[model samples]
Each structure stands twice: as structure tokens, then as C-alpha cells.
Target: MAAFRIGEAAQLLGVSADTVRRWVDGGRLPAARDEHGHRVITGTDLAAFARSLAESPSLAGSSARNRLRGIVTAIVKDRVMAQVDIQAGPYRVVSLMSREAVDEMDLRVGSLAVAVIKSTAVVVEKP
Candidate 1:
């Protein structure tokens, strides 16, 4: 059974360690003291809590499983294409699309957008 310390859990969840501590303190997330007397979250419990946090009613019909809601941080447009940057939680998602599509969507800095990612091959790495 794998367990994560508060700092590790926070890094995985893209939040600060203090936020994880608060969640544990407020009973939003379950934790147990390890043998060393430090709080730790079981991997199963952490997965459930992460799922709960990711549920979004607005994205109910999306076919893509990976959806990140974020504000548009930057947009660069040329004559034919545009590049958009979004800060979603602790992740930065970038997209390049046709300028016509960008104009039709009225995408601009500070606009709210959702990045729907559908990838067949994704590489996962551990540090």
C-alpha cells in the first residue's frame, strides 16, 4: 500500500502543502499518522479525493477525458494561425490553431477556456 506525505500529495495534486493540510484538518481528505508520527494519505484515498475535485457538471458531455478549465494567459496571432497559452491549475496547456478558428471563438487574453486533450500516446515519468 502506497502512502503519500502532505508535501508529496500536494505536489501530485498541483496544490500547496498547506492546502492539503487544510483539507485533512477539515475532514475533506482523510489522513492517518504514519509510524513516524507524520500525516500521510493512502494512495486509494488520495485517488478518490482527486476524482471528486475533478468532477465538473459543465463538462458532462465532453468526449475527451482530459479537460482542463483555465484562463487564457497569452495569444499570438499571425495571418493564418494562432498560438494560445492557458494556465490550468499547475499545468500550462498550449494550442496552435487556425486564425479563423481563433477569431470565431473570440479567444483573447483573460478569456475563460477549456483545453480538451485526446492523445493516444502519453509518456509518464517519475522523479
Candidate 2:
């Protein structure tokens, strides 16, 4: 039942604000005008749109469903490996991948990207 502004939607989608505007303008995403005459996206609409995007084969792999969209905070590259860090709201997700993959994805600091996480097991520790 929550509503989000264009900027907030962009941050959640790991895209630029202009991209969200374009989506709204192009009718790809649904939005409504607020009292301030600003575009507002409902959480339901945004989630559906995100699901569509995530289902795309080219954008995110089909196996990974837990997608956290955010901006790249840091990237450390070595000869064959690279460590990428993303800040997704209050969560920070890090992943290590091949240098080639990193370069192919054009992952750099400040770049908008999504961290697709597919984990099989999660361990819990008592306090």
C-alpha cells in the first residue's frame, strides 16, 4: 500500500531517475500524480515491473530470484578475480567474480547494478 517517488523507484530498480520517468512516460510502468503534481509509483506496480525485468533472460539469470538493486559502492580487481560491493538500502552485498565478468558487466564504482542472490543454505548462530 506504500507509494514511492520516481527517485526512490530508480534507486530500488538500480536505474537512473530519468529511466523511471521514461518508463512512466512510455507506459511501461504505471504511475499516478500526487498532490504536488509529482509522479508516484505504487509498491505493487513497482514490484510487478521489477519481476518482469528480472524475468528477462538478458538482464538477470533465470535461476536467481532474490535481486537487490543498488549502486556499486566499490570494486577491487586483480589479475583474474574481482570483488564487487553494492549498497542496497540498509544492506551491503558483496560478490567475487571473474575479472572478465566484471569487465563484461561494466561494473564500476557508482554504477547502478543488481545483486542477484540464490542461496541454498543459510546458517543461523545463537546470540
Candidate 3:
């Protein structure tokens, strides 16, 4: 079985380290301590949590009708910012956001995610 540290889980879930800690502390996401007494989460559990987060309506909202679901093709992250590219059918949506946000959302190539657009604005809401 493969297990990831809390930081890794946070990266995979696209959430902050504190957020992941809160989830674990609150019991929203299940975790177990490793031999080093550090919190670790399994890949399966992380995937399931990601799915729930992706499906939650509050994150995407009901008014946003222009939602594109697709696979992430590329991601470029710097010290403070990150660029993510997603391919949704014939359309490609690119977004630039905080490096923390990108890390928290675990946005990476070959991962499934969604791009929400409203009017001229584009929001990258990935799972």
C-alpha cells in the first residue's frame, strides 16, 4: 500500500497544509499516523476525497453554467504563481493562480479537473 504524508495529501487535494490538517482533525478525511508519528493518507482515500470536493456544488456554484470538464495537460508552477492548462474537448482553458492554490488543488497533467467560465472570466476549479 502506498501512503502519502500530510503535505503530499495536501498537494494532491489542492488544499493548504492547514486545511488538510483541519480535515484530518475534524475527521472529514481519514488518516493514520506513520511510524514517524506523522499523518499519512492513502492514495485511495485521497482520490475519494478529491471526488467529493469536485462534486460539491458550493465550490462551483449553481449559476456557473459554463463548466468544462477535461483532463489537465500541463502545469507550470513558480515560487508564487502557477499556470495550468486544461483540454476540454476542442477548447483549451488556461489559468494562472497562486502557487499555494495550485498546490492545494493538486493540479497536474493527466489529472481530471474542471474549468468554469462566466462571461469573460475563467476559473480553474479542479479536483
Candidate 4:
């Protein structure tokens, strides 16, 4: 039964506050006012909306279920290995790979990339 303010919902959804306001105004997102007259969205509603927004098809032929589209923010490389950082919405994904693979993919700062994640274990916490 957790609730989030408009700003918090926007941050969680990786959108501007104004955009979230518009969604509420346009009836695309359901919201209610708190005692202080601040608009709040329930965590359940937000999760449904997030799922709807993620309905788009992922990369063709990719089996990974988690895909985060983002821009490359940094790249640190040594003779053998490289670290690539991608800013995907409100999340930052970091990957360590071989320098040869980096060169083969030509990944660089400002490059658009998707972080495909497939794991058996994931950690979730309540805030």
C-alpha cells in the first residue's frame, strides 16, 4: 500500500515531473490527492504503468528478459579489460568486458546501447 508523490513516481519512471503531471491530467495515470493536497500515485498503479510502458519489443533474437536502453556515459580501459558505464534512465549499468570486445563493438561515450541482463538471482529492497 505504499504511495509515491508525483515527483517520486516520475523519478521512478525515468520521466520528467511535468510529463507525469500530464499523464495524470490526461487520465493516463491514476492519482489521488493527499491530506496536504499533493498528488500521489499508489505503488501498485505505478507498477502497472511501468509494465505497460515496457511492452515494446526488445532486440531481435535476444533471449534476455531485462533490457535497459541507455547512452554510454564512461569507458575505462586497460590493456586487457575495460569497464563501460551506461546511464539507462534512473539506473546506471556497468559492465566489465575485454578490451577486444569493446573495440569490436566500437562502444564509446555517447553511444546508444542496451544492457541485457539474465540472472538467476536478483536483490530487491523496500525503501
Candidate 5:
């Protein structure tokens, strides 16, 4: 792919040229100057930076704040509470002693369950 100029990159990212320059200066976005002092943006560098930004804390926190969806596999109802086995991902998460919440969700085995974990923390990983 052809490299974009600073202005073009700013337009692509929906930001001002100065913001893009700031990112470059902050090492979020990497750029170099030609002999004529023109800022040249590399497509490779842009892609790498985009991947990094996607895994950034801001984006992750916003995503967690967005929503968390899952399913209920089992529910252990007690005298006053219930333990719910929720399958949210590659793992199963359990929420114990939440009778009212379980009832509010109408939770049962094989029922769809959605858990909203609002957090400012961001989790990052590599495959």
C-alpha cells in the first residue's frame, strides 16, 4: 500500500493534522521527515500503530463499559440465594449468592445470561 502524507493520515483517522503530529511526537504514531522537511507516514507503521491503539487502555475500558453478553449454564438455588454458573467466553464464570439477580434475570439452565461488568480496567493479550 502507498504511504499516506500527514494530512492524509489525519483525514483517514478523522483527526486534525496537529493531533496526528502530536501522536507522532508522543511515539504513538511514527513518522520521518524527507530532505524537504515533509512528514512521510508509512503504511506499515500506521497499521502497527493502529493495532497498538486498538489494544490501548482507553479503547478497552470503553468496550468493557459498552457491554458484556453471555449465557447461563447452571443455577444452584439456595434457601435465600443462588449460585449461577455463567458461560461468558472460553471459560465459565460463577456468581454465587445472588437470588434476586438470578430471579430478575429469570435465570435457568440453558437460559441466555448477560453480565455487565463496568470497569475502568483494560485487559490486553496476544495470540
Candidate 6:
């Protein structure tokens, strides 16, 4: 249950903060308050919502990309830019990001990563 501020959630959800607020007010979403009493959503709730999206029969076209969460497992520096290997559950994705990001993050075998999938892109893929 990791809490996120409304603005952070809005950024993740790709919506306006006001829209998130309305969902909270309308009970279409849920939020909690900290000791300081600010509205917040938790990572647990977000994961649950992702699971719900997977379970809903109406969204049969959903893509498995939505289920990804990864960790930066390794980096291979080359004559060119470095390559990053992110382990997303049973899947390993090797991708190239800016060397700056790798340096700034100090990305190593244990560095955390969140593989983002914008909702509109959820779709069917060939089995």
C-alpha cells in the first residue's frame, strides 16, 4: 500500500488531476489520507485495478503489456551507448535508454523499474 499524491497518480493515469479528484468524489476511485490529511492513492490499489482490467471479460482484447513491472538487472557498456536488461516477471526486455539515465539512476542489477503501458494501447496480440 504505497501512497501516491493525486498529481502523481494523474501523471501515471494520463489524466488531469481534476478528473482524478472527480473520480474520488464520485466513488469511482478510492483514496486515503495520511497523518497530514492529504488525498492519496496507493500502489496496491493501482495494481488491483490493473488486475481488474485483466479479469474483465469485456476487455478480451487487452494486451499483456499492461501486466509488466520490471527491474534493471544489468547493463552492458559498449563502444556505443549502453544496453539495459530489465526483468519483467518471467520476461526479460533488453532496451536502450540514454546513458545519462543509466548513470543518474546508477542502474544496477537491483534497480527498480516500472514498465508503463498507456491504457489506450491495450490490445490483442497473436498467440
lDDT of 4 by residue, 20-86 (tens): 9999999999999999999999999999999998776654566676888899999999999999999
Tens digits of per-residue lDDT, candidate 1, 1-127, equal: 9999999999888788999999999999999999999999999999999999888686678767788779999999999999999999889999999999999999999999999999999999986
Candidate lDDT (C-alpha), each = 0.94, 0.90, 0.84, 0.93, 0.73, 0.73
lDDT for residue 96 in candidate 6, whole number 0-100: 79
**Total clashes, candidate 4?**
0
Residue range 8-125, candidate 3, lDDT tens digits? 8876665678999999999999999899999999889988988777675665547666667889999998899999999876578898889999889877799999897768665668
**Model 5, poorest ten-residue lDDT window?**
60-69
How displaced is residue 22 in candidate 2, in Å?
A: 0.5
Clashing pairs in 4: none
TM-score of each: 0.77, 0.59, 0.48, 0.84, 0.41, 0.42
lDDT of 2 by residue, 11-51 (tens): 88878899999999999999999999999999999999998
> What are the runs in model 4 whose C-alpha is more than 4 Å off?
none
**Superposed Cα deviation of residue 57, candidate 2 (Å):** 2.5
Ranking by TM-score: 4, 1, 2, 3, 6, 5
Candidate 1, RMSD to the unseen true structure: 2.4
